[model samples]
Target: MEPLVQDGEAVAIEQEAPGDVAARDMLLDRAMGPRWRKKTSQKIRQGRRPADGLAFVARSADGGLAATVRLWNIEAGIDPFGRPVPALLLGPLAIDPALKGCGVGAALMRHAIAEAARLGHGAVLLVGDAPYYERFGFTCAKTGAIALPGPVERERFLAVELVEGWLDGAAGMVVPTGRYVTKSRVRATAIAA
Candidate 1:
């Protein structure tokens, strides 16, 4: 059922249409099912926020949505060589569960990467499986030199270079873009309350 396109043809993967949040929510609900809630319940998810970088979804030639992916702007900090790691953060990349095994996810991922690269990003950072992400040239950042406030699979905190070897001299911790500061403020208020 994993099809890259209808009959091996390329599907037009593009940035989500204007005001597609509802559709994105619905898609996540359907694709993730109950697993979404449990994962959302984790406190770590609160502390460790991925920055919004870019998003792409697979659509039929008729414009019917098939799958989705999103990116966030995040910082990987400075590397051993005092260089900053500029990265596009990706997450909640869901393909309709029904579309699992189909090439929808792959198409969206490829398109997303291409878009970010076109936008001049240094790398992509995501929390995902080693075996799964390996297909896209990603590797675990266990020794990566970035820190996370919450728990994540050591091997799953990964980064992929948009420019070959972009990470060679960069090292540091990942932090949510501006959103993290907002969340921190909210948390602080809650604590004071």
Candidate 2:
């Protein structure tokens, strides 16, 4: 992705690299508070690698992580025919406190969604402020029948279909289906225990 200039500061949106782990965690903690780890969204992302090419980070001109977003592979319950419905789960989009209004977050959102569609994904689901995410086409319209593994505000569960009607009739509890990180790989990357 190309670099974006927000308020005279050049910000680059790029793939989340291995070296970005620590900075990404710190930024997430600061933006979402320590309790963020306990959120239902975290449950679906735990121990999984992000959907291929779907993790992104925004960096300021100084090379500091400014914002981040990732999508994970998930089973959005089942369709009317009882087949597992595949979808992408997007979440924990965090921005540096100082850059909240600088368009960094929006840039990352657009980049992530576009990348997901380009990669042939069918739909994206997320738990977030409807008003904020709606501008990006996220809505509770197709999510009424969808449920997370844990409690989530009904109004906050949303979805945006990349392929029209991809989520039609999707229902039940959303669960993680992304590739799991092996213990050795986790230790080597220091991403988790």
Candidate 3:
């Protein structure tokens, strides 16, 4: 199918076709850096489809997967001090080496964020360089009540609340959907009330 073209650039975002299995693997294998490759591979092995959680891919002029991103369910917001909120988590954002600096990553991010907002997601969270993500309106997750499944530096864990005041008085850990359910310390025994 033809790509979604705009701003003098020929691009497309669409449902991944069955014929894309090989292409998808290739992109995933190279685009994700070392820190994320293992987790990404595990997800693939578990038979997760990009579309299962709003994964959208950016294709190049040649119809190649230049970039891809997935929106997973994550809890974010305030602490018991009154600042936790739930938000869709965006992560493992990857860009094809050849397509780097060509705006593929940016396009994918914009599209994903827009889609999440359209779906009524209260917010979006991710771990990444603050400088790079700041341009997209993401800020260091204040309220500090959330933690990842594993160790993560504070500064890099950022988020963008879709509704301005959505996270104003909420608190909780941001856990992967189904991976944690207590609404408390996802890795421990904390709970939200």
Candidate 4:
């Protein structure tokens, strides 16, 4: 991916390198607070890696991390017609507090979605502010029947079809396809060792 120019400087958007994990988690904690760890979105993303080519970061002109976003594989459960829907989930999009209104965050969103589509993904789902995400073509119209594994603001559930009509009848519980290991299970394993 090419770096985007912002204010006469280059804002590079690139695949998140392994070394970026600590910085990325710190950035998200600052932007989203400690409660961010307990959200329904976090539950689904708990032990998962972002889909191939879908985890990205934006570095500012000074080479400081500026923003980040990731897309994960999820199952929209079985619809009324008994068809299972496979989709991508977007979340934890965080921008540096100092550069909140800068276009970096928006650019990340655009790039992430476009990359997902380019990779042949059919649909994307997210729990976010409808007003803010509507600009990206995410709407609650097709998400009325979808529920997150944990409690979430119903109104914040939204979806966008990467392929035309991909979300038409996607209804069910939003479940993570990733292997989720509970914290207690980890403790139990440690005790048995």
Best-matching candidate per lDDT: 2
Candidate 3's C-alpha lDDT? 0.65
Q: Quick one: best TM-score, which candidate?
A: 2
**If the candidates were sorted by their lDDT against the true structure, best first, what order would they fall in?**
2, 4, 1, 3
TM-score of every prediction relative to native: 0.74, 0.96, 0.73, 0.88
TM-score, predicted candidate 4 vs. hidden true structure: 0.88
Q: Candidate 3: which stretches are off by over 4 Å? A: 1-9, 18-22, 39-53, 77-84, 178-193
How close to the true structure is residue 187 of candidate 3, measured as C-alpha lDDT?
A: 25
Q: All candidates' lDDT scores? A: 0.66, 0.92, 0.65, 0.84
RMSD, each candidate, Å?
Answer: 6.3, 1.5, 8.6, 4.4
After TM-score superposition, the amount by which residue 101's alpha carbon in candidate 2 deviates from its true location, in angstroms, is 0.9
* Candidate scoring better on lDDT of 1 and 4: 4
Instruction: Give the per-residue lDDT of model 3 (tens digit) for 1-193.
Output: 3665644667787655645545655676687644464552233223222324476777767777777777776556454565435567676777778667777688788888888888788787778889989989888755366666556677887878888867665555554442323333332211110
Residue-wise C-alpha lDDT for candidate 4, range 53-153, written one tens digit per residue: 78999998787788999999998767568888889999889998877877888999999999999999989999999888999999888888788988888
Task: Look at candidate 2 and tell me the lDDT of residue 129.
Answer: 98
Best of the two (3, 4) by lDDT: 4
